[model samples]
Target: MTSTAPVPDPSPTATTPASAASRGARSLARLGVHVVGDGVDVVVLASQASAVDLVLLGEDGERRTGLLRARHGLWHAHVPDVSAGTRYGLRVHGEWNPAAGQLHNPDKLLLDPYARALTGEVSYVPEIFGHHVTDAAATHHGLEVRDDRDSAPFVPHGVVLPASDPVATAERLAARPRVPWSRTVIYEAHVRGFTLLHPDLPPELRGTYAGLAHPAVIEHLRRLGVTTIELLPIHAFATEHAIAARDLPNYWGYSTLSYFAPEPSYATRASRDAGAEAVVAEVRAMVDALHAAGIEVVLDVVYNHTCEGGLDGPLLSWRGLDNTGYYLHDGGTPARYADVTGTGNSLDFRRQRVVQLTLDSLRYWAGEIGVDGFRFDLAVTLGRKAGEFEPDHPFLVALASDPVLADVKLVAEPWDVGPSGWRTGEFAPPMHEWNDRYRDSVRRFWLADAKALAQGGHGTPHDLRDLATRLSGSADMFHRFDRGPTASINYVTAHDGFTLADLVTYDHKHNGANREDNRDGSDNNLSWNHGVEGRVESGSPGSELRPVRRRSIRNVLGTLLVSAGTPMLTAGDEFGRTQQGNNNAYCQDSPISWVDWERTGWQDDLLETARHLLELRHAHPVMRPTRFAYGRPRSNDPFIDLAWFGEDGAAVEGSAWHNPYRRVLQMRRAGGAAANPRSAEGVAAPVRRDLLVVVNGALNDVDVALAPSRTQGWELVWDSVWESPRERHESAVVDGAFPDAGTVVPVEPLSIRFYLSR
Candidate 1:
């Protein structure tokens, strides 16, 4: 049970006024307190309390106090003088009962629900924890009844602010750097890691919000051609008890402390001194800067759980405001929480109030913070019911229907730690999901069978087709109704798995650096070490394996760029930054996870490959369609966007998919009529065109017969092995008139080729 030691006399500076409402509020805010309304019409509601006091700390550090004394069954108080920028907190008096979830003690301070700004971090000391502090006090109470040294100094203080419209902010941001879903290339990065090691960033600005907008960082992003920068969580967070004991902070910021407050550590000098407004201004400035450069900012949000732990956890904002109401209470005991996020307590979205709070928080961030979109962490759990997570959960529907959020990109991680956690491609339309299937398929098609190729067995054509579908946005995964193609957020590697460099360098997870008994990273890595692990091409330049690695990187990147859906590139992958094999570098905030801007010789080559691929994707309108054109009449474009052909120029069979020995895929892209309605008169439209993409995974060179083309002569666009501009394919024309002889295109082993029909 929570019992506070006798409260020490308030400092004369914080003495309360003797008004009746103030006295009454001071009497009733002790138990089950709920405060609502903007400044000047403050209404404090207390369910069980003897006394309550409303204390307001001004910007000048001076505090004013008003009492809220309990009366009848409900204790209510109204203060009309309160206004914005007014910092307020409550002190309540009531019976402390921990087992019954009524942890109330008049001696402790309470934070207001509608608080706009927060002052300090939640201290994990004994004063903050209910049982820990009270138990320690009980032993001292036995020794001396008058020794009232209760620790009130550790509690978090809330700051009040005048209400403002969040919608206006969103409207201003709507036109800023909004790339269509097709052209968008997302670069997922950590706010701190993005520039922590940058030499150009000032020592003071390094890793801060200001650092993100620094010229060097911006220039680097521009060079990479990323349309959107998806930052890892930057919300205020708290270190868990176990992590704190180990002296490690929550680096990822997933364990949220306050949704409204930006992580204080991310801010610069002005933000720390000027409070939450400074944070908003600085972050908005960053967004504005990115918008000028045609780049969107997508925040990785964590709303499924809070930093507050389970039963023994500290009574933070939600716990103190309404313990049993805000969290999912266990059926066996309403006092305890139903843990689902694996972060101790799960928010009860089933509660309408909790749902409202979540919706409000999203609006606040999107509208005020000026983010283009949000990537929900463990999104499935946010909509979880008794068994499975529903697609039509109230929260999901609200987000889909809410005008402010509906237009903004709503991507989901799409799974949790519960039953059926691997719910990929399940989210509704206008939403993109991380396609792990694409990651696995790309990895296996290149690296996994390379070892077998050395033994003279080429990988299967079925394997090639599987890779083909992923490259075309895995239509098999999504439904016809769910905005086909864009529904899949395709990636070969993401934050949780092996990085692009590691995916080629290591076959196993190396998480020894996590300091958690090597239990952190994943083991299902579909990587191959290419004869030697964690090193490039076995220390040989221009070796046989070098082509394989280069071709593999090119294929994955080219596939991602030309694919139907949006593509995401992990930060620093373009430069081939390797983690030495460590997949879970979440704990290691040093160079292990940070992007090394300096590129090696091989890295520069890879970067060039990526740049050329991106240019090619941008040049082709057929690659990035607004909708799946191949699907049906209702779809946008006419001709099937992509068509797969087997070795003899015939349709691939479904049963041939599992054969690993066949590894050559001929992919065709067909162009269609434009979306403009003015074409009714059959104006001279662009010629019907088709291009061929050939991938050969054999260890030795092979000959790919070019299919007879009807359009003008083909131009060589790309080849994996040769340096981009220097690589070109030209041959004698092969048409039906000259069917007696066919053109033979030399295909390099473990390489990909692109031919464009002019």
Candidate 2:
């Protein structure tokens, strides 16, 4: 039973209007249904609605409706006998005028904007839409009339969850790895794709969050030495209409439906059957397990937009409630949305309420769900106010100042499909950005440049200079705000692009599997096919170039790890996972997207190389610096913090960096002198690493001379020419096996060598 009990006089507070449509949304702090004094306090934010009613469904399918009283732009009602797991929906009554941007439909059931748990999946039928679908003339005219069909059967219900225990939440937070950014190695992965085909997991557990936390999965990640696992979106999402029409669901989970609810699709069938609580519990368990393994979990959040598509999109959660308030729209058309995220209507961060919603969801995930951090997808959309990207936007300011997110690691995808959206190094402090320049430079140096040389082309001028800048740190892009090199999240391969193996095998993207007539995906793949186009076994015909391909992969891997930035390794890249040249496999849910666990002999060797590279990186502070390596240290340190060298072991200066055909560049650094971070005892002591990195970007071998060493000879720490990391085959490690100062050594073609002074 439901009772429309009197709402207590809430403390009315107000803030400055963020947008023109924010007139009705006046600081309604209690926007969602909350369990409070007596029974439940249901506060729905429908500032412009003429009438609002709460509908509760009984376990036996009985319904109870109660009218919510409107006050100060908020609809409020205190209901009796409401408990946890109660299924409910809202019927917001207002005129449905599409031209005027008012999409309120009294007949259609709406979802609570702050629903913590959702009960059902939205059926993408005509009934779920706001406009009349059956009426031929009405539909053609575009909202000449509203769809009067009862949408109760098509839409999902908002589920109430039991409040969290403070003690348990605190305990979870305390167990976080909290790894320093300098020492952090991120492994980007998708929960379903990570363990979907793992042979050790039970069939029932496959493709579920439970499987992601399995011992085997944890063991693999631990062995990879990745401190943080940045998962692809796990928010409750609905497959797009176009993708669903083809009977293939959205594999990337970017089309988010609800921010608070965890995606039940990635949970076990048993967990789904148990209830939404069980699904949530499964996610928490996965997080707890990852934390126990000393690994942090970071979510890829799509707050820039919702699953609801463009102007004529479906009436999901936000659309039906308050169209103009939640979404950014053109003032001229009012009905037309400002699509910045390319996923359709962009969420208006200009409004305080929307900012509040995102902040609340983040806090819930951090406090209640026990996750570490978040990576904002299409993050430029978040900083867009008045249709222009602003670095000092209030939304970003709130994030920087929020106590809940103070220590939280924030990463920005840093671009959108909107105008002038390529703002890579423009995000505020504490927000690391995905450095596309670094990715392109590394790919070009190891793949495209090699391809150019092999084809008798020298490529673009200043290519070597750009590469040298990226090798040290792209300070030209990030140093404006004094944001250090760690602000750059350097990655060559992500979930979107070609896998590490595909980068070497396919020069072009083969995305015919997407049924787009091979027109989809980017054409600018900076890749090289080593003589052949398709997969070639080790001993198969035309497989002689396989070793060359492996060399290219090793060069890229070594460069990415040895560079001065926060390196992110795409899952399966360490062992050369491929997508059969399907770069944009967003619709692929089969083996094309899942990480193949079956390893070949060469793949085992590649994995060992990745492990060795990570070990070297972690052991030496010179490889990863928190501040810029080019810092003018406040302390009087004699060691040169950073220095670049040419093939002659001399400093690379002036126009010499612009030589495109100049394939050899060396970087040398001393530990503790770069950033000069004080020791735990507040003393700046000399760090004990004499690191030197040499890369030969040419297709042919070259002899490079070792730099002058004060104490002793240079030790052979690592070289990309070694097919196996442990088994040097022909080379030896350190101690007289290495050459003395100023000695020229034969550097392999398309390889990088790491040396430490003995």
lDDT of all predictions, in order shown?
0.67, 0.82
Off by over 4 Å in 2: 1-28, 70-72, 134-141, 458-462, 631-636, 673-687, 733-736
| Model 2: colliding residue pairs | none
Per-residue CA lDDT of candidate 1, range 403-478, in tens?
7786688899988886787788777766678887887777777767675566455443235667877767788887
Per-residue CA lDDT of model 2 for 1-758, tens digit only, reads: 11122332222221122321243233246567766544566677776666767777776873444444455556665666678888888877776777778888766788788888887887767777777775211223366557778888877788887777899999999998899999989999999998888999999999999999999999999988899999999999888766666667789999989989998889999998988889899999999999999999999999998887775556777888888889998786537888888777899998878998899999999888999999999999999989899999999999999998888789999999998999999997989999999999888778887887787775652358788788787898888677889999999999999999999999999988888888888898999997689788768898899999988889889999988899999999999999999999999998889999999998999999999999889888877876677533325455677777888888888888766778888787766443455778988755466788988887778888776664467778888988987755357743246677678887878889998876
RMSD of each: 5.7, 5.5
Name the lDDT value of residue 251 in candidate 1: 73
Q: What does the lDDT come to for candidate 1?
A: 0.67
Kindly report which residue stretches of model 1 are placed more than 4 angstroms away from their true locations once superposed: 1-54, 57-96, 105-115, 133-152, 161-171, 451-465, 536-547, 629-640, 675-683, 723-742
C-alpha lDDT of residue 518 in model 2: 85
